[model samples]
Target: MDESLLSIMEVREDLMVSPIGDSEPALRSAYFLKPIAKSLDGPVSKVLSSSMTMSLPPVFEPKDWPLVIHFDWRRHTKKKWVEWVDALQLRYKSVWKKVGIFEAIMSIKCSIAKDQNLCFGIAEKWCAETNTLLFPWGEATITLEDVMVLGGYPVVGDPVFAPLQSHEMREAEKKLILAREQLWRRTKAKASLSAWMDAFVNSGSEVEHEAFLATWLSMIGFSSKGLVSTLVFPIAVHLARGNPIALGPAVLASIYKDLTLLKNSIVGMTKQLVLGDKLELEVTLQSPFYLVQIWVWERFKNLQPQPRLINHEDPMMFRWHKVKALKIDNVRLALESAMEHFCWRPYVQYAGKFKVFYPENETLVLIDTDLDKEPTGLLVSFATCLRVSLLVGIQSTIKKYLPHRVAMQFGMDQDVPSCLPRFDGTKDFAWKNYCRPISDRSLYFPARLFEGDITTRYAKWWKRSLMGHQDFAKNMGHQDFAKNIVRRKRSPRSPQVSKANKNGNVDDDSNARKRNSDVDAPSGFLLKRLKTVSSGNSAQDGTIANESIDAYVPTCKNLSNPSSSASTAEYENVKRISPLTKLLAKDTVEPLMGRLEEDFEDANGSKESRLSSERVSLSGTQGESYTF
Candidate 1:
């Protein structure tokens, strides 16, 4: 037999026949026959014994058991042993098959785990051994490689037992702690100065770079704490190399202290100045800045029984009066000319009232109230007169022909009367005097009163003209009744006219009548003659006979005649009036001149040509005289 078989038979013989198996003679004898047979095969038996000893039983079973004892030894001991040999062979084949399958499974797990960087390969080997020897199928297997993979690292193979450097690991741990500390410090600093820090941190270029870092960290399962440290390291190195972790915290703390100091200072100053009953020192020290200056000045002027200590001559205290006038003589000439040109009789009566003077300042004031009792019409006439006078006054002043600077200085101080007032106060003398009772204490005294009976005569004339009434009753010897009602003249006993006469000179009635009648009769004749001549062919004959007569005759008469002779003569006169009127009308003068030029051009070639012809005709007729 083979050496391994001989050793196996010897071990089987020893275990199959125990000393207690003497009663079983055949079994004992069979067990002794195998060892005796193995002794006879000397060299083979030794080699077989060594080889068989090296062979172990299934890891899960005892190696000392006899094959015969496990099977039936009584029946055909020799055949039974052969059968046991076949069964053992079958068991070895099955064990080999299971081991092969286990090894194949382990190989597959290792290949897969390596590719996937998983720990299952190591675990599979352990699992096979555990299944065979310990728990069999009771528990699953795990490996150190599996643990490493689960903890988020790649496992190469079985974990080798090696010593780790304690100092180096501790140093790594300190680095991580310092990184975390620096990261927290930077985060706090950024939050502390978030408003100003956004200017740098939120830059487009930096944000994109930071975003890439954040994504890379995420792929490795790094937390934000780790990423903050990694990203802020370079910034800390550049800004604060030594003790980088403390740099950001220190900066933030210092900034906070500065802000607190500023806030406290502002609060302290505000408490001292704004929350007190006393006048602010700054305002109290500056006299011009004080409110009392305005109050004192106002009281000094307005308080009754003024103290002698207050200077009356102070320019601030003196109220300058400015009186403006529309010269009556000039205004009368303008209105008369307008009436004559319109071919309308003058319905307005003038009272020979002239000369206005401010008693307080000796300032002369002249105004035109030429339109009888019609206030609006008088206002319109006054406005026209004022406009012309203003233009002339401005031109003359610019030429230094009038005291314009003095007038302007006075105007600056004079407070113009308001169009309306809340109450009849001292400022509103007209309203107070007109509306309030004379006996009332609040009645205002006029700065200057209008004297003479001009307004009374105008009011009567206006009533007559507007109502289309005649003076027949007054002429019919019922003068008293006519004056009392139709003319609205005062009753004989009323004191208004008596007072006026007392205050000023009363005109002689006979002299006034004589003067009015003479003037009226002559003016009526001249106007009638002008109208008739202007409407007839007389103007044409008159123009030919002597063109010089055109200059003396009114411009209205010349304009009425349609003949070229009359147009040419009228154009000349209008041109002469143009430059003078321009100086008086300012802005309106330009448009008027343009119209004149256009009219002259349309009539003849141009204004210059028409004027030349008229001038020649006038010069030629200068030696002759013509009757109107």
Candidate 2:
């Protein structure tokens, strides 16, 4: 505990913030990322480089793949080799940029393979062929049964929930619960109307009460089109004359029908990516704050982003695949295979990233209503509540695990760690910075958390016993760490002079830039590895079977002669992935077997990645640098 916190008074639970507790009204909740900034003179930039290009395997038609031949690696000429390499590299860059690089290159390769393989394409056919199995995507009203079955339970194999759950809604919402008001009760029903009419009610600013009026004074009629005051004016006039007998019930009933139906119309998109078919869901699970922030995807398109870095209109879809069917070690490999063939769009119109996360709170709550599909197309409940505990728990956890001194930075705040500079001063130059705003440059931490698209260790190890399946990926791994990058410092001298005197080649001219000759390589490539790609052919089982191995000897001039520079990994250093792996050509590791017998081959021959302190030169407008 912090020394300053010992002087505190009594602490109490916040009733308004609890989703599972009795609060005034049901609330809506979703996760979002908040932009933070850091100072950047020391570890200003992170680099991912490759000395050579690795070719992206071609995406074949899934149906066509089963008929194609898996040729040996000896048929192509030198020219063909170059063409293939260029094509593959281009594919890697374009695809990562297009869909967003959240996983290893190996997994991406696997996805591309699956998209082309016919066997994995069954979901689309199933969704289209059988009406009974499809999530009711085109509906206006959901049966109460559907909501109970899919959403009522917090845990299930293929669970989905939509609209408001019966028990979660406010009791006054009985107008909408025509099927059975007996299922749930409204709290203080009699006092609710009295308080609603009187101006003395302590509503505490609930979102549901935002639309409710406290008084009926505007009887002459308001000009607003969507206001209930105008629509219910006739009921007001009758009540005003002391004849408030029963019109409110009918009016509320009509509103109820619309509210229930309206909630179901705005749906959350869910799709199955072959990681595992079963989609387990949770409603308002209280979790680590960073977990939510890291899961959200941010974009730079907002010309004027809100100060808090939140977007209420933006929809986020988190797609986590469960592959308990495979060996525990093959998770990365299985994911690589899935991405090799094609990309999966879990939420097409949304700014969401797809990857995986193991569940932390994965228990089942059985509303146990046994209907398969809701008539209103709602397969799951709408998220209407957010539980942000502004208590010491969140504060301490973030402080300890993702210490504020080293947490993700967005360049908006002062006193933050150094913000990462542009690769070439272009805001969108790096994949992480793509589509990010020019002014919103920030350095995020633990690639798994801040990337907004990569999966975390929790998903990899959550509920392992329950999964009862082996890892799906046997042959996948991360690209070799980039090494030998040339990170430089800001010097008064020009690039020409700086290279000559302090840091230079044995054969350098005096005009070359002089660097501090006493600096060691900034840091070795050290990041949570969730990426995979090799400059090789597609393996038989729809995953990359071999890690791309690149061998390159750096010229003496680029080598650093360190005297006393602190290692980047120990301090504030970011890793630079050299486009190379240290694996040999002769080694071959087979992956977990697929349900169907498939062809397999060893893909090889790659590029080298050099890691060094990355030297970043501001390429665009050099505005005043902003910090935490």
Candidate 3:
């Protein structure tokens, strides 16, 4: 906690931008880098340097996993389950919207593609101490903004543990308990997820909808072992009644926890390598790590695959559906040189157009029957950058959401982040403390939020920090920050001195060219190289995993097609039969009002066709649609 980097005396005020008299900036940058630098030695460094030529240890796949291997419920998604989901979309569309999980459910229905090989490599480089990837260029990590925009979780909402007391909620909880008990009796060991789902899902019971949400939380939101954990009952019941939950923070917490676990596993693996001991390695990651791979693909140009271009109305992850990528044998070398190619603000391009997906207001009235007029997904993006809040995850898991730590992800200037006092309240009181108003507004100007701006102070501090770890810098070839990097600046000299220097055989001109090319190479070159490799034939390099992105594929069809109106009409017909239609007759659920205004084209290039809404097949087809 650097006193110079913050104004701790002023309560409820912006800390980073507020000036304090004569205090030095926080020196924690080196503190953050030390652990990362230490981890990059011995076997880890040896493996990365030679991964391109030799077969290295399979860091991505461990020998044994504690929890269920599947990250999604796609395998359990039968025809009956798809039909129930359709009814759910129609029945409680407002419930889903209030909870900020509409796009998440849509992405889940599309069944996110997975690439098992990408996680361990990326996770090995993660620094849990600072929640960033310690690259030679600077710090970068997945922020709450990534969770909001890419994972479709809302940044502003009621806490996950907000108390609920209603007849319907009570009944839902009871049903969940009964289902778990029934499964326990059948197994005589532990509760079975499959048995519980088969018993309650789409059974025409009043609580079936709640059961569906619980299944999602178990499989997607809060992953667990084979058992149907009772942790999701409260959340599911709250969501079924059209209440808001700050799911974005909770989901981000899970990712961070899993990343720390993976990092620790690598440390353990390296220790075994040094001790001359052969042990079966086991890695356990129980979150939607697909999003982690997606984050890497989105920012690092060299790692990206060719992705399909879909309408903005679609979830951003859909762009990478079933996409392919070039197999990079040397990940560390690519990451070391990825400084210029990284997109600091990838979501900036969709700034004005994608506001429809987020909420505009900080406060939401969840119980109101008229859900049509709720604020769109605009302001939450800005709020996520300014707020200091706590995120509560499954089974009482808690983590802090410190946006200031990675402010650059939100297009703000980088600085030493301020620290807050730990919440000392009781468990019941602490769970409800998440949705308070943001105290900092010094850097909230919307116009400049996506400009990819930086400050000289940041660059100088970053350079000094990298230099502190001289060994890591020199080994990774960070020539720009090397001790010998600075040379005598060329200034106008007398003709006699210039000729005298030239006569001594000094090649200053070539030296200048070499330094300029390495240090100030144009960004477009790497970007173009990324695109070329993305479009190459798949036969050139075998697909690493079933999941990865191709960031440059064209959209399936034109957005201005004449059949757009018919698509909207068809979508409206499905909404007309919603169970909530009569319940909230005053304000009908509007037809795909936001991004769906432009009809999304099927993969076959058809102008006026849509997938059947009846059932979703788990055939693992390239263009399966469960949009209904």
Candidate 4:
């Protein structure tokens, strides 16, 4: 409610969280509660055990994971889309900026390597009750920060479903409809994706450009397969007219929705397995899940494959292009012991160097409507990272984002997050009110990368918040690790605390100057900028329509062969292992088995379990290519 209590949503020491989905309303909860200390250690926290270990549920097992049906159309069709995007970027890079999709479009240029094993492993840890991953170390989730930087979606913009108003926008929609109708007439079927591309790829009209964006959103952004859908026409029209839509939050919501689905399906399979029933259900992921794996790679350093290259000039996603993930014998065990290996603030390390997103004075503002200021710039992008708001996913799917829950991601202290109110999926809830200012100015806080600790009561409350009762703590296999924390009077990593002077400004000028110097520094090697090509016509706007698709092919480096030495070394020095290690060791599924035989010692005699290593291919039906 006030400036000093900006990042916390405090609660009473005796307060308790309600059961995850109780029918009763949450009692007397407020967005702003009693503030907690932001220090790394608080009030001599006690630990009951010397070592911590976790008990992974049945869902963590690869043997229990449901078969995934991914959209893989890229392998079947000629990649004309690549040529179209390259040509489009050259002519309309400015237009892309106006529409808030410059970064999103640029990101698709590179192909990210797929690792479904890693994706399935992380999805298993998702806690739908709190929208955070419950790991042995603490709670962490893919935040809006990850979405903005990795996925290149705009954080602040008009709602995705904002109604079209201008006559030009309506005319553009009519043009798209007519074009699709013509294609349908000739094909004697629904609009063919290939036929649609031929009709609009280089038509030179602005409407055709809008059609290109619509197809891009359907195929690349939102994952629609085969026949084209008309759902994205309105959104495309808005973009063509230079209006920025909030695709960042929308894409994030869709990712969250798909993760929840995957998590729920895994739980369902676990239940089926427990009851001795044959599992036949398959899970279909329709969102851009490569972003999910990239999120994992960015934070979990131990699990990341060595990157092929680092180019600061390109979108952040380019770093992982064609890089293969390390093959871990036990994903669950590796994740459990990865607390110290996790980079709590990865973006902070590259913030000064990344051309895509660097902090600035203007970026500190919550929201600014100045048209001259680029929407995708660090200004709006940075502000979007710190605010708590609702995300609008693809058509009808909606999710709430509570950044305050993992305030450490934004360089702030952890506290009890405001209770996210449950919403009915069947109704359109508060659709008209989404355009309101997303942040409260009174609760502004500066971003810092140094990790902060949970409030004294927050640490105690988190243990019980899982199932909404004290009994849930007894069920966890891991012990309390509060004693690992130590109080420090001053840390070089932490920003100096400053007082608000009489003029309502920070008194610490040294920290401000240091931040400015960092912002001015170059990151790594910059890529060579592409030279402009002129189309020689005002209508074409210098788009390279005649350029050959083969002239600019992007090639991927070969994946490194899986090696046991590196994978084994990470866990070789471990002193303790969880009980699940034995169960995983006995799994005879060759593909699921990692090279951990050298490290794991199963004292009990090994028992054989029949688990299938053959993954079902959905490409025959789905017909879409996978993109990271």
Please report the candidate that would top lDDT against the real structure. Answer: 4
lDDT (tens digit, per residue) of candidate 4 on 1-628: 2333232233222221211111112122112222333432322121111111122243355754445546432321346776887777777788887765776776665577777678777876676655677665456788877987787777666777777898878888988888888889998975767778888878786677888888777765454655677778888888877887878777877778878877777667767666778758776666777888888887775787654334344567766655677888777667766655566666644544432232221011111122232312443354456655556776777776666656666644456554544655431343432333322221222233233434545655555443243232443334454433332221123222222234544334454445444322121112121111111210211222353322111111100112212232232222111110011111111111100000110111111111122222211123221111
Compared with the true structure, model 2 gives a TM-score of 0.17
Q: How would the candidate models be sorted by TM-score, starting from the highest? A: 4, 3, 2, 1
Q: Write the per-residue lDDT of candidate 3 for residues 1-628, one digit (tens) a residue.
A: 2222221011111112101111222211010100011233344333222212222233323323221224443344545545656767877777787677877776665544565546656765676655566666556787787887787877666666666688867777988888778778887967655766777766787778788888777766475664567778888888887777778777888888888777776666666665766765665566777788889887775677755545545677666665665577656566767655566656634433343222111011111222232244333344443445566776667766555555555434444443345555654454544543222211112221122222234445455555656655653446342222223321211000000023333223334334323222121111110001111111122222342222111112111122334332222211111111111111222111000110112122222222322332322234422221
- Pairs with steric clashes in candidate 4: 72-624, 72-625, 73-623, 73-624, 73-625, 74-625, 329-594
Better of 1 and 4 by lDDT: 4
Winner on lDDT between 2 and 4 is 4
The 0-to-1 C-alpha lDDT of every candidate, in the order given, reads 0.18, 0.18, 0.48, 0.51
Ranking by lDDT: 4, 3, 1, 2
Model 4 superposed RMSD (Cα): 19.2
